[model samples]
Target: MKAYFYLLFLIFSLTSHGSYGQRPTYSEDEIIVKTVTDEMDQVFKSPDFLKKKNKQFQDITGTMVVDIGIIQSGKVATFYKVENTITNIDFINFVSEYILQHKFKFKLPKKMRHKIRYSITF
Candidate 1:
């Protein structure tokens, strides 16, 4: 009887640990936001890109709003909107192109498309 009880307890403890083990701290949405921010940071910090951007707008300082759509396959399907506080046509075009060229590195469920509105500050 003692051996049988110990075996049962061991099985229960193992199963319980498996079911409630370590979990991710960040939510799915937060993870996606972090991914996007990290990618954008790389783009903003690139030497060649920064040189070009600086040449166009020496003192550019504002926020740019970007609306991105992600398909079920996790690909960036479209760039719906790109708006910035600085109303320079050249600046908008350059930034818009840079954003549109970026490839997001994440996946979503196959049920429906996901849309995210992200802001970039300069």
Candidate 2:
């Protein structure tokens, strides 16, 4: 009886002390923006993209603020809006199309839809 009581106590203590495996929490600025920034940098720094950008958008210089909405699944971007500062229509269209066609690799919990603001500098 004493051994059974001790074993029960041990089990209860261990279970209570165990972590419940909660999902990691992130600040919006830290994870979401950084993920977008990293992906944008990777895409823009590629030689092929660079060549095209230089050929077509060499003189373009401005900052574009993008509002991106992430789906609840967080693996995909639901929609995005570019607050354009540059006057080049073609450049704006290209950037918008690129964003629209791309899927984000970073994923978050499906608890809620997430939105983030990102800026691109040229």
Candidate 3:
């Protein structure tokens, strides 16, 4: 009976993990990118001081989409996967921090934002 139980447990574990093999996992960067983008959208909609500041920096108006990997301790491990023409690193870094600090308010679209896994994108 013990041998049979062990075999059953092995089979169950294998089956459970087998289905997950086909799925893709998100890196840390992907999570950060999504977090930032969603936060920015939310901040833009709410009437607040940040919105005014965002507007004031109109020169940095171009969309900056970045893939960032943030650890649980809130440290950014990677910051190079940005997909934008803007060269203002300071602003991008500031936005990244802002996103991390605030709770995400915007509900991301299922199709477009669903790709984000463990990382965030802007």
Candidate 4:
């Protein structure tokens, strides 16, 4: 009897996960990227992106990966493990700080953990 119950639980678990994998409407990564882009625009659209550069200034370009944690309350509670960035530390900190301070327009699913990479050229 115990063995039968375990088998039943396994099948149910697999089927439920399979359902979540299908995203005929806006894959999770797509939603995450869109949300990040929109949030970043709210800040970087100012003089920040269009600031005049000095001769010594160089544009930094690379993809930055961030680990985000969303709580069941429909809000982001953590942003960490910034990676794949090959720019100055100041720039990385600036980007990371902006991400943490700004809220994504989309409310993530309950108890969701997401990671995404965004290209930066500035």
Q: Which candidate is the best by lDDT?
A: 1
lDDT of 3: 0.51
What's the TM-score of every candidate structure?
0.60, 0.61, 0.38, 0.45
Across 1-122, the per-residue lDDT of candidate 1 in tens digits comes to 99999999999998888745443233277676776677777878889788988887888889888887766555677775467787777887787777666665555655666667878788
Q: Rank all candidate structures by their lDDT, best first, as comma-separated numbers.
A: 1, 2, 4, 3
In order, what lDDT does every prediction score?
0.72, 0.71, 0.51, 0.58
Candidate 1: Cα lDDT at 92: 78
Over 4 Å off, model 3: 1-40, 49-56, 68-81, 105-122
Name the lDDT value of residue 46 in candidate 1. 88
Instruction: Give the range where candidate 4 is weakest over 10 consecutive residues by summed lDDT.
Output: 49-58
User: For each candidate, how many residue pairs have backbone atoms clashing (under 3 Å)?
Assistant: 0, 0, 16, 0
What is the per-residue lDDT of model 4 for residues 31-64, given as tens digits with 9 covering 90 to 100?
7667656665555655664462222235776666
Candidate 4 displacement at residue 42 in angstroms: 4.4
Q: Give the runs in model 4 whose Cα sits over 4 Å from its true position.
A: 1-28, 47-87
lDDT of 2: 0.71
By summed lDDT, which 10 consecutive residues of candidate 3 come out lowest? 113-122
